[model samples]
Target: MLKKNTQHEKVSHRKPVVLMSMGAQERKGHDYQVMTVKYIKPLAEHAGCVPLLAPTCCGSEDIEQYLSMVDGVYLTGAGSNIDPALYGQENLTPDKQQDPNRDNFDIPLIHAALKMGLPIFAICRGMQELNVALGGDLHQKLYAEPNMLDHREDGDESVDEQYADAHQVRLVSNSWLSKLLEAEEIPVNSLHGQSIKTLGAGVQVLAHAEDGAIEAIHLPEVEQFTLGVQWHPEWKAAQNPNSIKIFAAFGDACRLQVQARS
Candidate 1:
């Protein structure tokens, strides 16, 4: 009988590669595409995945190529807002920062990624982008709306305080998100001036704030894990059970994609 060398035998398990969309920034006479460390850390720590940054400074002509190499897509919150023109709306907040380059790249990227059945987790501005890509419009100034609560964080507060839990969001009964988190309501940080005014096609509301602002959404049409949240769950995700579960779920879906491809 031959003795099996179990110690020397190696089994390989590939980590899912998530294509993280970058925001365009210009500084010191140079143009740069960047994503915050806050968003990146959670994917590496909680999600158990590799992060691949996709540049939006350059147009998304090569989006298909970028998608081909990754198992999932992660759209993160950005300092800039999406261009209103994409969703048939005139420039309502022209003074606010808008990234047309990112707009051009992410919209097509969203459509193509969906076509390829990639799991997507979008946050803040990314959520707005997803809504616009799906034919939805934003309030532009959510605080200005009648009876709407102001969702923006005070600029004077420290970063940690700004990202702290600001309000509670009521999760829809029998929602996938509610089931995953095992909670009917969860406290979330609020730091945006705009909110979804009109829902996009196939977009289903998952959670809402006390003021009725849409806090989270999901696409029921996509069999893969597709979720968009207005809050910044990536901020100190390890400290929060809800954030950990959300990222872990996304990571699991990406791993399944990796398995399918293999």
Candidate 2:
């Protein structure tokens, strides 16, 4: 359990603590990027949760304690790719980099979250982790599909330009995402190279790309808030109403979790 707010009396009220799965960068001195300051802004201001950076490459038994300390879990975009063997396939991207540490962290957290009925929000590679963790498969290279669209943006463009709306994703009618965005379709910025080829058990396709690739998914059987998006909503959560809704709903779930735990 979280320590009661021992700070200012005016701010003694405890906020829901949400764990963020940090990505490791060996090139950057093998440091973990768990302190995603930019990404945590909307989560704190809009989601109303205290975002905590979690240590990756830990034991499965440690996951229980970590989950016990937090109200929710958030998996973010990573620089490394999950091993193809995770889904019963060989490494298709032999030339690319892989992060077994990230996979080890994501897979266990996702499964434990499901068993604990904890709220979860995954983005980009995080979504792929959720799929694979739940017995789904990946397309490996979405660009290879003649009928599918490339989800990445221009590399030459500036950061803001690259993160601009890449395409429209149509939401499934009556899906949780459709209700959150209050629209049949939503414009999202894309930067993922791979996409989900098959959905996992208890997972529902919530949104799709123009070429019909899986762009978003959710745990239909889960009563807690669980959502995964192909795009990076954290890029503009405070500015985008669509992004705001996602975090806000997640925040509400975390608050409820805290309350239940208390």
Candidate 3:
């Protein structure tokens, strides 16, 4: 059983806690909520921080308790679209896979983390949520947009296998993302249908696709490191130099957050 820890433990002795989102599980037989711990752990450890598996299915008691204990948050990629209700639209197409439970969990968490100015690294769906939570919008379907290539390849969505690099994103000059990557443009694997349409308040566009789709975002006003990218850096970080640099930068940010608390 996952018990909620009530107190905020000592900071100096604490590990740098990263709150990652988890998915709903299927029951094998007995009562157990099975969820796979995805991207953040191995990559985080490589960057020198401990990763905590923070599930979105937890009750309010668990959510509040865990958020209070963590040092930082990592909003990971999701397979479903952000509920259209979140952006004041009705569900145009039904996606049964959507998890309202997880959506509800993350919305408030994003706001709370922003309020506290915690360092946040959002990838793919996480990036989209950050924008929506800040009053921005998303392109419901990328391929529908004129001149936009298929953002996601047909028939295969998983990132574990070898795939062709579909497109390149041009980083804005002198932008935080460009500086971090030290490059003008980079090849990225696109596996998302929804993307940033209008950037949120205080959020700056850091990178864009050749088709003008928003690829990366940052909040310059926020003191802490807050960035969102459209690609899955965790999967590509193993071999791609640019992806590796991006993760290394995030890890560095996590380290700094850990140091400040200590």
lDDT tens digits, residue span 1-262, model 2: 1334443332434699998877766654665545466578988988999977877756455788888888899888776788999999998888877878778877988989889989998888889999999999998999888988888778899989989999999999987678778899989998878899988888889999999988899887888988998988999677889988898999998888877765
- Overall local distance difference test of candidate 2: 0.84
List, residue by residue over 76-107, the lDDT tens digit for candidate 3.
88667888888887776585357677778778
**If ranked by TM-score, best first, what sequence of candidates would result?**
1, 2, 3
**Which of candidates 1 and 3 reaches a greater TM-score?**
1
Task: Summarize candidate 1's per-residue lDDT along 42-92 as a digit string, tens digits.
Answer: 999999999999877768789999999999999999989887777787888
Best by TM-score: 1
Pull out the clashing pairs in model 2: none
Instruction: Give the runs in model 3 whose Cα sits over 4 Å from its true position.
Output: 1-15, 25-38, 156-163
User: What is residue 137's positional error in candidate 1, in angstroms?
Assistant: 0.8
- What lDDT score belongs to each candidate, Candidate 1 first? 0.91, 0.84, 0.75
Please state the error at residue 253 of candidate 3 in Å. Answer: 1.7
Model 1 bad stretches (over 4 Å):
1-12
Clashing pairs in 3: none
